[model samples]
Target: MKLLLFEDKLRENFFPLTLTRFTGDLRCGALKLRQRLEALLTDDEVSFLIDSSIEDLYSERHPDWQINLIKPGDKLFVNCLLKYSPTLFDKIQTLDHEQALVQGNALVAYRSNKDHGSFDPDSVLKQFGISTENVDDALYKHPADLVHDNGRMITYDFDNFFSDKDNSFETEPGATILNPYNVWLGEGVELKPGVVIDASDGPVIIDNDALLMHNSVVIGPAYIGKNSIIKVAAKIYENCSIGPVCKVGGELEACIIQAYTNKQHDGFLGHSYLGEWVNLGADTNNSDLKNTYKNVVMHSYNDRPPFDTNTMFMGCIIGDHTKLGINSTINTGCVVGTGSNLWGRDLISGYIPEFSWGEASLLQPYRIDAFLSTAQLVKQRRQLKLSNKERSLYTSIYHRYQENQ
Candidate 1:
């Protein structure tokens, strides 16, 4: 059977995070949503139905995988935002042709026998003579949902994927592990002296080549991704996912820091989602709780007004390639868009538009040439380059912002 993961109409609700990648690529647990789904459907051939904005980039990154090209056959279509579980997988596997599993108005998965050149959930439902089956499975509606669901997802991913695995590396002398059975270390992981891992509440999975320096405390459920570094005396609280090649320090709680980002300094970041290539300079911190302790309100790309998140804790949603200078202060529920540079001691709050430059109150559009140059340099530090395709995409985004202004 062919398995196709597709994004739906609510993609813009994720905003700046989804601006650079697909929703399925978001880190929910120890693994991405797509990764967990692929693991469960290992027997079937996998493909993706992604937005046209990212089609070329996705195709360029994963040359071997099929994107948007549907063939005539019995196929299983799954929503990328659907939260994965063993029970859900079993239910989806039981789907017969022309049947769709839905949760409320959102279609979760369907099995179809008809040939469709492209994927359109409405078209598929109408043309395939689909019969609907109601399901209670949850779907991610906003970026904060990733933060709120992280701990549960971590436990689920660990129980399903790593529970049977033996430690691939030995813990060094003076490195302490509480509830050792709940901790899984991957190959080449270095746990330096004074490093402590506490997993009594939930599991902790440290991926390959990760380094935990002296005096660091990791309280699970948490994930330290491949080649990532936990700086000295860093406090990584429960429900945090630090993605591959990141350098994290200070304190983090219920946060998802995506790949190649750096927070390698003393700061407190809580209940937030950060995209790839983000940098938080020394002592930069964000406020997760308001002075009145009210539910946080955040701006959405599709929603004109800021909407209530229904949660008292929310720090910020920072887009890819954004940078914050030393001692920067981010107010509760702030949203920073892509390719921006923000600095100063003033409190940064409200919705900052894409490619914005300068202090919080004195924002201006960043020169496209200058932003691209800096972006190229940033990638080159990791031995990667900003390709022509990426450059064109960035240019288009900049022009779109300009056109709106």
Candidate 2:
């Protein structure tokens, strides 16, 4: 059977993160949701159906499949945004076309054949003669939902990652491994001396090509993704997901740092989600827990009421390509949008709009030309080119932000 991942209305709500990649591409555990799904369904053929705005980009990333191709066979359509339980794949494999698995109002997974030509989700229910059943699964519809549940998700992924495995990677002498039973290592990983890994509380995974510099301390349940680097003396606490190709340092806890970002200095980043291509300058920090310990509230577009995130540890949600200046402070529950360059001495709070500049209480819109030029340079530094599709995506998001204001 073939597996196809599809996005839903939640795509738009993802905003700054989905501005570049789809919901399936968002990194939560040690792996991207797409990667985890692929790993779980290793024997089946898999592909993605994402937003049209970034279709070409996603296609280029996965050129083996076509965006519109719905093959002539039995297919399983899976919602890309659902936080899948690794063990659920075993149950999913046992089911037949007689039943459909859904979570709440969202139709998460269903089966149909070539006789059903339409790829639209609404068509699947009517086309297939299957029955629907409500299944309890975590459905993520908003961006902050990632930050709220990342720790638990990371731990879950860790268990699925190494429950039946041994130390598959190499470690250097003098590298201390506490509770070795809970540590999972990937091939080609190098741990320098003076590094300590404490896995007693939960599982720890260091994926392939991840390097831990001397004196770094990694505590579980934590994840260091492929090609990522943990700089000297970095304190990575429980429940953090550091994605591929990132450079991390200082302290991080219960946070999700997406791919290609750099936080390689003394900084305190906790309970946050940093999108791709982000750069946190030296000594940057954010307030996660409030002094009063009240619930954190986040305001976004669409004139909705302030979202009361019942959690007390919600940090910043920084969008893609945004840069924070050295020593810049982000207040609790702040939402900074895509392509913004924040540089100043004051602490940032509340909602900062897309492509914005200047400092706290003195904000100004960043010009289009300046934003593009900097974006081009940033991509170049990472050996990537800013294509017309990316430029169009940025333009569309900029206008949407303007309209929301």
Candidate 3:
């Protein structure tokens, strides 16, 4: 059977994170949603059906993968937003042809034989005679959900993928590890002197080429991705996932940081989800809990007021290509949009629109030319070029935001 992962209409719920990529690409634990699915369904031919807006960019990044290609055979279409679980996996394995598994209003998966050009859940249901099967499996309704479930996912990924006994690397003197059996150190991992890894609570998996510098402390369940650096005296709390090529320091608690980001200064980032290419300036801190300890309310891309998250701990959700100024303070449950530059000592709060300039009180639309120029420079620093496709996408988003205003 062929496996096709598809992003549905609720993609906007993820906002700025989903602005540049697909929902399946978002990282929660050691692996991305797509990677987890691919690993579980290894026997099947896998493909994707993503939004048209990011098709070119996605194709450019992954040229080998198939997108929106439906072959004439038994096909299993799974929702990219569905959280991975043993029950979900077993149910998917038992799915019969022309069966649609759903959870409330959300589509979980569909098994079909007819090859249609459009493969959205709604389109598939409309075109074929399918029997609906309701499921209780959870779906990721917001970005904050990833943060809430990070620790559990980390433990799950570790037990399933890295439970083998392999002690290949050596740690420097003064580097200590607690619950050594629960820790997995990948190839070329460097644990400098005075580094302490405490996995008494849960497992810790440091990927290949990752460096934990002097005096750094990491508690589990946590995942430090490939080539990431934990700076000197850094304290990484449990339930944190730092993606590949990142440089992080200070204190991080229950956060999901995407690839190529930097938070390498002394700051406290808690319960936050940061997108790629983001840089948190020195002393940048966010308040996860409110003064009253009430549930945090966050702004969404949908047409509605800020809604309660039902959780007291909710930090900022920063979009890709955004940079925070030194000593910038982010308020609880703040949502900062893509391509924005925030500076000054003021408290960055509320919903910041895309490509915004200036501080929280007086945000202005960032000039497209200036944004693009800086973006090009940022990419160049990483030895990558800002291609015409990216420029065109950014420009269109800028115009769309302006037209709406």
How close to the true structure is residue 39 of candidate 1, measured as C-alpha lDDT? 83
Q: Model 2 Cα displacement at 189 (Å)?
A: 2.7
Which 10 consecutive residues of model 3 have the lowest summed lDDT? 119-128
**Between the candidate structures 1 and 3, which one is better when assessed by TM-score?**
3
| Cα lDDT listed for each candidate | 0.89, 0.81, 0.89
Query: Per-residue CA lDDT of candidate 2, range 1-405, in tens?
Result: 888888876676676778778888888877777777777764677767777878877677667865756777878777787776655665566667756677766777776664545467655565446788777754676666777667677777777766755654457988999888788888789999999999888788888889999999999888898999999999999888899899999999888998889999998998999998899999999999899999888865566777777788888888998988999999998988888888899789998888888887788877767888898998898798988878877888777775456
Residue 280, model 1, lDDT: 95
Output the better candidate (1/2) by TM-score.
1
| Candidate 2 off by > 4 Å | 86-91, 94-98, 122-130, 162-164, 168-170
Error of 2 at 115 (Å): 3.5
Residue lDDT tens for model 1, 1-405: 898999987688888888889888999989898998888875778889999998888888889988998888989999989886678878889999888888887888999878787788756655536798788845788888889999999999899888865654577899999988899998889999999999999999999999999999999999999999999999999999999999999999999988999999999999999999999999999999999999999987754677688899999999999999999999999999989999986789988888999999998898989999999999999999998888887887788764465
- Clashing residue pairs in candidate 1 (N, C-alpha, C atoms within 3 angstroms): none
For residue 247, give model 2's deviation from the true position in Å.
Answer: 1.2
lDDT of 2: 0.81
Model 1 TM-score (2 dp): 0.96
| Highest TM-score against the true fold, candidate | 3
- What is the TM-score of each predicted model, taking all chains together? 0.96, 0.90, 0.97
